[model samples]
Target: MNEHAVDILTELRDLVREFVRERDWEKFHTPKNLAVSLSVEAAELLEPFQWLATGENGELSAAKLDHVRHEAADVFIYLIGLADRLDIDLSSAVREKIAMNRAKYPAEKVRGDARKYTDYD
Candidate 1:
């Protein structure tokens, strides 16, 4: 079954949760280990772009983009798995953080500016 765009994230998250459960790997997925894995995967995603010159972040070749895509998926999988084990609701957590960021970076003061939020003061 196809998931709608708004539902796909949750659907993929549930799929990862079920895949881990069926394999009985819960004991192997402590938050610390998952966090480590997530960081490692994120680093791997950066590998293909590491040697690119300036202004090259958007210039990845098709093959490199595919590699980046897979590594990013790995990061997302581990992140959701970690969140599931911690009993965190991913959507609400992200929403709350976004709200905090919005408060810290009001558009009137921050628009077109890339400085840190404190710079808005």
Candidate 2:
């Protein structure tokens, strides 16, 4: 992470850490288990988007949107827990990934195209 980047993740991570510590649930929150939990939460988050046609308006009712938000939060929280257990720096990882993607899909070559990098030729 860059020095100028906000330190918001630390606070959120600590909150998750404290919540786990208080519940004495660390024993059950193994890296593998956390990864599984994160995936499960992600699947749950996808529930709100299911059964929609390709052109269907994604806007949902207020209550259903709230449900989506809660499920999405569960996915994020579990991901933070998994990353904490794995000692992964998500900010740096994301930044590096974005850089790599930019290299793979240069604007000049990829402009107005949706092809894969391997198909650029």
Candidate 3:
């Protein structure tokens, strides 16, 4: 096992690219297919919390948490793979979105509130 784990998102993207190059999988990795896979993986990640009510503490066993972690990893892996396939820069996009969110929800208005950005005064 590799003790030193590389950046997971970058590793996943590189793995996908290498697989595509080795097996010609790019022909099947269309935007629509990737989008559907992304949604499916996201749904898998949400499955563990499906029964939990809002603001309720759900019972998640260690095994269940492990399963959730795997599902979440799958979701992220597919997302980065899709981004790589589409030539999108995920890091820059995330930074840009965070900047936009900061402008939308200044700390003074949302300091301790859990309200939506639009609901903030």
Candidate 4:
């Protein structure tokens, strides 16, 4: 991540920490609990698009879009919380995963294709 992006993420993470601390919710924010919350929030994030043929690419009503936005934020917050609980660096992990995926799905070989790396000859 760039310096600005890192700063934003740090700010958000700190905000979540303070919110949890203020609520005395840290005890409940265990790695396991946070992981479950994250997964649930991810599923909620998919709710707004559940029946949309075009998914996010199609226009949504303002209310539905707002719902999607809030669900996405919930997922992000839980993800950051889980990272904190696990002492993981989200940016580094994402970057490393991107690098690994680049190798696994090289553009030259995977471009215009929608198959897993294992599916390619």
Could you say which candidate leads in lDDT? 4
lDDT of 1 by residue, 1-121 (tens): 2337438767887899899889999899999999999999999988888768842647788889899889999999999888878988777787799999999988888889999987655
After superposing candidate 3 on the true structure, give the runs of residues whose Cα lies further than 4 Å from its correct spot: 1-9, 20-23, 53-58
Candidate topping TM-score: 4
Candidate number with the higher lDDT (2 or 4): 4
* Residue pairs whose backbone atoms clash in candidate 4: none
Write model 2 residue lDDT over 1-121, tens digit each, in one string: 6554537787778999999999999999999999899889888877767775541345566666887789888888888898899999878878999999999999988999998999867
In terms of lDDT, which candidate is stronger, 2 or 3? 2
Candidates sorted by TM-score, best first: 4, 2, 1, 3
In model 4, where is the ten-residue run with the lowest total lDDT? 50-59
Candidate 1 Cα outliers beyond 4 Å, as residue runs? 1-6, 54-58
Error of 2 at 55 (Å): 8.5
Q: For model 4, what is the alpha-carbon lDDT of residue 112?
A: 98
Error of 3 at 40 (Å): 1.0
Ranking by lDDT: 4, 1, 2, 3
| Candidate 2 stretches greater than 4 Å from native | 1-5, 54-58
Candidate 1 vs. true structure, TM-score: 0.85
